[model samples]
Target: MDDIDQQLLLLLTRDGRASAADLARELSVSRGTVQNRIDKLKREGVIEKFTVELGRGEREHQISAFALIRGNADDDRRILASLRRIKEITQVSTISGTFDLVVELRCSSLARLDEVLDSVRSLPDVADTQSHIRLRTWRS
Candidate 1:
């Protein structure tokens, strides 16, 4: 991507719902140019998808944590599928470290978080799990 494409992505990253006209104004290009660039970005897979960051009011009530997990290698696939079924577990990533996976959790309450943790631990494939409750989030 060129400088304009890079700049266009930054604008979209800041606000996914930004209009073509607004993006064009920000990038000092025509609306058609902005639309075409967005299309290209999507086609080339530079921008996979757009998502939302829960607002402060809702986020304040959200219990977020990262669970570092160790599990049997043979059960990795099943474990991931199970984790995906639990709504509170938003992200599950396999990483190279002492832990086999890192799971991100966002729950409605402490009780809910506890329940989710227990459910994760009970999975036969899950050998062990260490959780760290998030105290604050300065950046995404």
Candidate 2:
């Protein structure tokens, strides 16, 4: 990771789909040089994968919330597995500090959130849960 590599990474991070010729022009290098550097970056795992950012508003997206879930250590796997099976649950994390599990969910309405909470409350392992709705997101 030299200065050139760092610059290339910065450019690629902004747009992974950048063409070799475009990158070469931006970096003031030949196409072949850009290709080789990109190859090296990929080989070294500097760029793991590429993904697209979806427009949530136009999609079947719903209200999203973050939940702090407290549960017993023994039920960690089951609780996480259950969360994974739920389509609305997009992200789940075993967190430190106050929360055992941090869960992110997308729901159509408050009623849907209530339903989801009911299921979570029914889980014997879940001792408590605190949820907060997200008002807006400037960036993903």
Candidate 3:
């Protein structure tokens, strides 16, 4: 919430596995101070959770796409719940525009992606969908 906390978060974002001692050394503070700050950040919900970033080798073979969905209002909950069960669908968000929901998908092959898209299309109340395959990712 303060300058020190901001700096600590920035460092953690770069390397979530950094030790308290390492952080303390970089921040010119005691190890306990770093630990306490990290604990406080978690308690206050500023640090939601730690996660891993896959290496290029692990991701290069994967195909990714975004599917924009338009569905009936009454079936929104059902449609969303169904989409959540698909392993390839990583993220979904409700949007205010032409599309009612935007779903992010990742699969090992184009055939798998098509299968997932077909599954989505068959879901009840899903009136229409437009998919855009990601050619390349320049940045996160």
Evaluate all candidate structures by whole-model CA lDDT and list the values in order: 0.92, 0.82, 0.92
Better of 1 and 3 by TM-score: 1
**TM-score for each model:** 0.90, 0.70, 0.86
Point out where model 2 deviates above 4 Å: 3-9, 16-21, 30-46, 59-61
Model 1 residue 87 lDDT score: 94
lDDT of 2 by residue, 1-140 (tens): 88878988888887888898998999898999988988898899888877775566643467788889998765598888777777888789888876799988888888998888788767768888999988777643
CA shift at 103, candidate 3, in angstroms?
1.4
Predicted structure 2, TM vs. truth: 0.70
Supply candidate 3's per-residue lDDT for 47: 97
**Between candidates 2 and 3, which one is better according to lDDT?**
3
The best candidate by TM-score is 1
True-structure lDDT of candidate 2: 0.82
Model 3 quality (TM-score): 0.86
lDDT winner, 1 or 2: 1
Candidates 1 and 2, the one with greater TM-score? 1
- Model 1 over residues 1-140: C-alpha lDDT tens digits? 99999999988888899999999999999999999989999999999998998898899989999999999775599899899999999898988888999999999999999999999999989999999999987855
